[model samples]
Target: MSFPDNTVLQSFPATLNHRNATIFTANRTDSSAQQAIEDLIDARLQLRDRVSAPLKGMENDLFAKSQPLDSLRPKLRVTFGRAKRDGAFDWPVEEVINTLGAQKRGAPVAGLYGFGYRKSALGLIQEFFIFTEMLDGHLNGLTWLKRERNIQNLIHVSFNLLHALHSKDIVHMDFWANNVMIDPQQPTRAKAIDLENCFLTPTDHLTEVLAFQFGFYYRREIFRFVIEHDYDRLVFEELGKYDGIDRRRFDEIYALSKHENISRRARREIFHKGTVVTG
Candidate 1:
């Protein structure tokens, strides 16, 4: 339970999961790699510091509580966790999300902090966790699903992850950068965390996740987030390169996202029940 130890951490793939992720093995002696990480760390710290500047800039707390993400119902094989420099540690939040009474939440894959889980050790079935540090020589970052062309392969995989989550009726309140994850070297490594505000549907409910027939406005948002961020890269030049689709699907989804009428369709799809998308 000692955080799988350095040997284990090093041996394990840079990442896991099929949603969207890129895990790279650590470098023992790479100065540039170390510097790039330092740069990212600096940027992250700067962003955190900016939180205090809200009045003149923005006034928000730097860190909040970490929450449990999800886990297997029948089997304990799955789990998830959310954390930053610090986490609020809300246990009952899960109850609210799981209560299908106007709210449906995922049971959890589970959330384990690098240090917390290791200390409080939850039963023998759990794996010891350590802070997912952006170590000097080791950097594990989320591949912006629709943000970069080099990681373009993640589009289909991430879409499927989103589909699977929606199928269970879990509403991901925050689906932006910090919420999304990816593995650059491995295929299908996308992840969405920070379930503090998530609403759940039902684990057995196929309607929540993507059914072939269900019309989730997800198709549209995926296009929006993508085009707005990484669409211009040379790799994304053609839509066909994606999981193999015609160019029109791209334009089609993008167009739908701009529709003011039904523009809120995606939001309503996951949030409110009676909310209607005008289009």
Candidate 2:
């Protein structure tokens, strides 16, 4: 679909609300942003209790915050619940865009709208942007892995996602299958929807593996990739863990993964090396 010249498809309001929560682009009446907000509201209204697993307070809080939907957005796509270890009040959602920039590779993040606090109800809400076209939820975890028999495609897309973040000097502390979103049309490409625990640094590696889920050994190998800057090793090692992947498939995927990483690193090196001229 065509958009207007002044339209801000991946943009949000630059300020917070009176409650100090992040304000969404409710004021942008002419843009597609408003319609996106309406869609989120519609999705929330239609959400059933049985489907919301793990996220306990989802339905009640969504309904409570629904009245002022224009001024609010969900911290999670559909789920609702506080992190047992981390406090919801102090999440760094609003500042992430400024630190990390919007797009990684070709995929744009759902913009961070700010934070929302409502009395004794939903203490603090980390408001991030959402596009309905990308679907309201991410793939269901190992269930998806079982269904997705083409393991090579999953490895390439998932690893490319890691490479994209590491190239930016950003480490996604909580990397899990559920946090990732894959477009139905282009299943090969994946984008991260959750970014609350992301850390930015000039350092090449992240040593400690604190909080993680799904693929315990595989996740550690990803951390190893970040620490060692070994793209080939990551591809081979991760592929080795899955017995279903054949040698031919492994070689092909590994070659693509290696090529992409080398090209990415080369571009980064040149970009950071700056202008150098002989005297």
Candidate 3:
């Protein structure tokens, strides 16, 4: 029931997942490796203070009520602990709820019920977990687009969400299809999740985590599909309307984004920061 004393946890991979805590399962046959992994995980968890004091304080309160072993969820395979400096514990339940409310003006978002953290010998750890209503029959944007043909509504919904974030002085630095959930029940509407990287009028340095080129490339591809497939004018108009940029001007801006002479940083700033480029 307990990990061996010597497990060495692995660092997180660049590949994306909803949770920040990366779990490494112990191998009963290879006790040495499992122990090493567990030890590393323990060490990593104990050294971090990334979350706000209020959140950490709240988590400490929660931890006070439960045993560390009691915090483990078989489903998640994550050993819940105090918020870490790795930004895992930053999305406390209150923040998620507030963000959901803020996002109501744009697209639908999953509901967060509550959160909890755990304490260790090193004190409060930096990892935490949340409870949410399952986004039933939902898939990430990347997978959904590959299978679904009715792309217009999803695209519109994404723009709406982005515009809504912009209106609130928020920019979702991690605005990729993978982060956007497309629910089968709400085919036309997409829900934006993973707001951990979202920032309110974030400075360029703060938003360095965002992969602007990937998102811009995705949008450009979507734009091309709209044009090549001869999607209804209404769709184009709707995109322009929701995005707060003229529909007629999309091609021009997209062109500028792809220009070889333009610096990558400049292109990213133009595309993601909404810098208007006049002819």
Candidate 4:
């Protein structure tokens, strides 16, 4: 799926209508997929009541959203609903590309189309929607890495993507292989998706304040790799070579698991220095 060479929209419209629901797009100048977006919304509303688990619901919703529509562009993807505990609907791809200046950094995120929301009879927000360019012939990183002939290239690109994000002070809390997309045709090409959990911070560590505030679990290995600015451990992990990890670093981060009340500043200091630090 290819898009014509047109200037990407820099701002979202105040509002647009699609039946009872309102619509928004990443590019206001691009007038397409309005009916498809509304159809996605309708399908999601119908499935919302039947699904219970958040992740499971999203899996089902992806299928629902993929229903073919004549107006839907072949390159477009419409995602509905927010992750559990998300306070508001945020267009992370728009923020990363537009606000953070990641467009030039080779930050592998899908091109945003826009988002929309529907309000209930009482004027309360009911459903949320997101639209982005589809990554055709791409598989999740986990599955792709297993069969990829040149695994090194994918691993290297993954590290580069992470470095680009970290340079902008953005920590992608869910940097797991499942969140990465790899194109088989272009083996080295990788893209990061599922950006709702990402956050910007100056420190290299996942501080206690930020973790609890965002309901993020303290992932020691992720924190270790982020602080060290290295991807060797991740390469091993992704390749299913758990025994290949650096035991010293693993044990060091593991030691902090039992200390629940450590202060945010202390946790940050501990991560940087690899030593117990008290606030």
Which candidate wins on lDDT?
A: 4
Which lDDT value does model 1 have at 105? 33
**Lowest summed-lDDT stretch of 10 residues in model 2?**
205-214
Clashes of each: 43, 3, 16, 2
Where is model 2 more than 4 Å wrong at Cα? 1-22, 26-89, 92-108, 113-115, 119-143, 204-279
What TM-score fits each model? 0.34, 0.43, 0.44, 0.54
lDDT per residue (tens digit) for residues 185-230 in model 2: 5665666655545545433312111111122324433433333344
lDDT of each: 0.33, 0.37, 0.43, 0.44
Give the per-residue lDDT of model 3 (tens digit) for 109-223. 6553333344344433335443233466777775777787656655665666555555565656556556677777775566666665454443433222222322353454555
- TM-score, predicted candidate 1 vs. hidden true structure: 0.34
Model 1 Cα shift for residue 130 (angstroms): 16
lDDT score, candidate 4, position 204: 41
At residue 113, candidate 3 shows an lDDT of: 33
Q: What ranking of all candidate models by lDDT puts the best one first? A: 4, 3, 2, 1
What's the lDDT of the predicted structure labeled candidate 4?
0.44
Model 2 lDDT vs. the true structure?
Answer: 0.37
Q: For candidate 4, what is the TM-score?
A: 0.54
lDDT tens string, model 4, 1-279?
Answer: 111212323345445676556655544422334444555566665555422111222332221112121222211222232321323223332233332233344566655545455555644345445555566667776577567644445556665665556556655645555566777787566777766555555444433222321121223223322322243344334333122334455444433442234454444344344344432
What does candidate 1's lDDT look like per residue over 128-181, in tens digits?
112232211111223344345443455455445455565565655444333445
